[model samples]
Target: MAELQFREAIKQAIDEEMESDENVFIMGEEVAEYNGAYKVTEGLLDKYGFRRVIDTPISELGFAGIGVGAAMNGLRPIVEFMTFNFAVLAADQIINHASKARYMLGGQVSTPIVFRGANASAGQLGATHSVAYDSMYAMFPGLKVIYTSEPEDAKGLLKSAIRDDDPVLFMESEQMYGLKGEVTEEEDFTIPIGKGKIKREGDDVTVVATGKMYHIAQNAAKELAKDGVECEIIDPRTIKPLDIEMIIESIKKTNRCVVVDESHPFGGLASEVGFLIQREAFDYLDAPVQRVTLPDVNAPFSKPLFDLWLPDAKNVVEAVNTVTYRK
Candidate 1:
């Protein structure tokens, strides 16, 4: 019955994973002596020393490539990006090399590494920092994309990502890191990748959300329920090898769906989920699958402009109402 912040759970997962596997080591800026930008790696340096908990210069590209190289050479490295936006500097190593190395090498090497930490809009962080790139990264061949919306899911999936034998992109929302939830003290209780979890049950409509948008969809659901509309909410925890089958099944029962995501509308997770539902369960859908996402604009620094670009409860409620033909 103990409670932990979502960020704390993430720290716990990485800490335990390192203890369980001697091959595991962590590297990033402020990770060793400073504990980490968000304190997720706090006390690691004191426990493991500089050999394992390394502090690098502000070079995401260099460190990420080093992690990739380590994974190839038989060590398991967890590369933490201060924020995924900074990871843009490491795109080549991440998308071209780390993602395709195993397949390009004809399945000879395994990249058992985790590239993770905060992603998406948070406060006045502005255009360059606020954009979420899960869609861009998830498009790769040999990569696993993880998007957890809760504390428990964050801990379990992050642990699985670290232990898996392929390169994993574990995205965390900066806003959700401080939110508290229940997490088990067990060492390795992991949630399977490429699966969807149903958070709420309903017969009228399905609202599929990922990352921070999952909480928005849940808030909208509570409001809609007061007006006699029941909503089934599904969270596709991992984007690549996505749980499309679960979405197809949910749409079949609800007959209508509104996918909510924190990213822009085009080429986003919602777009992919919508296309999947159209292909597999088109006959079952009573209405078209609508998406609730940020407007296709660069996230602005101004408070009002940023709010306009972010998806919220009002938009989610409207999207569901439109899809369910409720006017």
Candidate 2:
């Protein structure tokens, strides 16, 4: 095991996969010469040379289309969008083309590609750049979506995503790139998609979170524990093929739940997870499910406003207290 930064772990996964597979290559804006906008692809260009570590112009749609075409022709391409906010410009390629190509071609082609970058709020980036699109992209049938919090999950899940036959949307938090955690150094370390892990166990309530929100949930859980409120933390690492079963089981054990998410309150992971819990474990629930999410509005640029807009430990603690009837 090795303690690695979140960005370093991601780079390790991509680096290892590319070294092992001749068909794997990386291409995106500033990826080669600039070492990636967030430096996640640092040193990759030197390691793999210009042929494998290619850079592109600031054209999300064009590069995305090229990645899709590469994938269809039996190449694995990792497409970094700098931030998912820019991915909106390439939604036609991501949602329509890359997502549906395999099915549209009757399984004749496999889009073994990964579209990844920072997601959600990254400290007052403003409305245009802080939108969370996990739920929106997860709605697609053929695309697999993953939002990892810890370095271990980041490394393992990314490896699996690169090798999977389906296209993957790997979301990271720009705020969490510096987070350090123990990650497996094994060559073939891989975590399966659609499997949720219980970060902490408790009997009072289940707090579900993903990406950076997981850390918020954990901090809230610690405070809750101090108050005799044991809260279980579950990280739904993969959002698209949601580990509904894991969350449901936790709810059945705890009989209460509080979902924490960075997305807006409506039609996001919180809404979907709350719905699934009710549907699958309604009889077991002792109280209504609560959610801690951003208000139904765009992210603000002001520092104070942005701080209030993003969900944090306080919001999660309040939601947990609500569901557990502690307040």
Candidate 3:
């Protein structure tokens, strides 16, 4: 195992995949001469040259369409949007074209493309920039959504996403780029998609979270532990092809559940997970499943307001308490 920052792990994944496959290439704004918006592709341009490490005009729709076309022609392209909020401009290409091409054509064509970059609120970025599109993209078929929390999971899952023969929306956080964690140095390390991991084990309650919310759940779990309210934490690395079975099993053991999602409450990941838990593990549950999520309101630009709007450890703890029937 090797300790690396979250951004470094992502860079390593891209570097390894590109090294192994000549057809693999990455393109986006500031990805070449500017060394990427977050420096995730810092040295890749020099390592792979301009042909493979490309920089494009500030047009998400244009470059994203090019990436889809490239993938259709047998080139595996990694398209990076400076921020996923900007990706709305390319939704037609991603959702309509890349996602439908394979099924519509009956497997005759495969869009092996990866669209990735920072996601959700990074700190008072405001309403338009703070939206979490994970659930929205996951609702569609033929598209894979992977939102990673840890460095190791990011590296492993990203490598798998690059090699996957479908359109993958890889979500990351701008705030988590500096987080450090141990990642395996094994050759071709890849974590399977749609597999949820038990991040912290406990028997009192099951807490499901992903992306930035996973860390908040972790902190809540620690706090809950102090009062003998053991909270088990599950991180569903892939939002699509969700590892709901694993979550059901956990709820069976704990008999209580609390889901924390950074997205809005309406039709969010927590909503889906809550519904599934009730359907599959209803007999085993001791109390109603609870959720901690951003209220159905646009993100505010004010720092203090943003802090209030964002779900935190306290919010998760309260949800856990509700589910566990703790006073």
Candidate 4:
């Protein structure tokens, strides 16, 4: 019943998890005395001390490797990147190593590691630093991905990810960090990894969204309501091991679906949802599944261009119309 900004809720999640589990520690760029690049780690160094809240050099691979190795050795490590764009430098460690090590070793080892921080276009951050890549991370089977679109869900999801027995990728949006929402006062609150929650119930169409796009879909549903179009907004919450059953159930009821995601249409969340829908619920669809996604090009630097590239209310409305057989 407490109101907290996205960043505050995240900070509380990390602080609480670390205090309760001595094996859990944070290692990231500027996480120590500097209090993290986004200040998500603010005041943590003083409370937990430097050893537990380490500020690493600008070496994503080095720190990521250390975190994975530590997790294998029985410590829970939260490794943060300044932004996920910079995580490319650590891909070898994340994709080939951290993501596959457990399976490669025949399940003899468990990596309780959480690689987190901002993902997606943040203002004028440009092509090099912008773009949502949680969908990209889903290619690795051993990695569990958790992305939340709100402050409260972010806290609940991140806490769940950190406490899990496997490697987790907690994708967040830098733009949503300052946003505020009422977070629960309960410490035992933890969201499951492969569940979907319908934020709105409607009959005309189902809009499946994740991360920051969930809020955009909510707004789009509101706008569509004005035009006498009903939209059901569902958040997959966790991309991998996706709640395909829940989505199928929704589509079976609505007979139409529109997927809204910030990632590109090709080989992204949109495509995955579309694939699942056709495979499991094609007979139930009244119209084709329409996906509103970013253009399959690098994220642009210009503000207007950036706006055009990301999923928005206009795109959602258009997709809703498309799937509902409207112009």
How big is the positional error of residue 83 in model 4, measured in Å on the Cα after superposition? 0.7
Best by lDDT: 3
User: Stretches of candidate 2 above 4 Å error?
Assistant: none
Query: Tens-digit lDDT track for model 3 on 1-327?
Result: 899999999999999999999999999999999999999999998899999999999999999999999999999999999999999999999999999999999889999999999999899778999989999999999999999999999999999999999999999988999999999999889999889899899999999999989999999889889999988899999999899999998987999998899999899998999898888989999999898999989999999889999999999888877877764
Q: lDDT values of the candidates?
A: 0.90, 0.92, 0.94, 0.89
Instruction: Write the residue-wise lDDT of candidate 1 on 229-268 in tens digits.
Output: 9999999999887998888888889999999988888999
Alpha carbon lDDT of residue 49, candidate 2?
Answer: 97
RMSD (Cα, Å) of model 1: 0.9
- Per-residue alpha-carbon lDDT of model 2 for 1-327, expressed as tens digits? 899999999999999999999999999999999999999999999999999998999999999999999999999999999999999999999899999998998989889999999998888677999988999999998999999999999999999999999899999999999999999778789999889899998999988999899999998888888899998899999998999999988887999988888899889999999888888899999999998889998888999888888888998888887887778
What TM-score should be assigned to candidate 1?
Answer: 0.98
At residue 98, candidate 4 shows an lDDT of: 83
Better of 3 and 4 by TM-score: 3
Can you list the residue pairs that collide in candidate 1? none
TM-score of each: 0.98, 0.99, 0.99, 0.98
Give the candidate order by descending lDDT: 3, 2, 1, 4
| Stretches > 4 Å off in candidate 1 | none
Residues 1-327 of candidate 4 have per-residue lDDT tens digits of: 899998998998898899899999999889998888888999999898988999899999999999989999999999999999999999898898888888889999988899999998888877888878899998888988888888778888888999999889998889889999998998577787788788899999999998788889999999999989999889988888788998999888999999888887789999988998999998999999998888879988888887888778888898888888788
lDDT (0-100) at residue 302 of candidate 3?
92
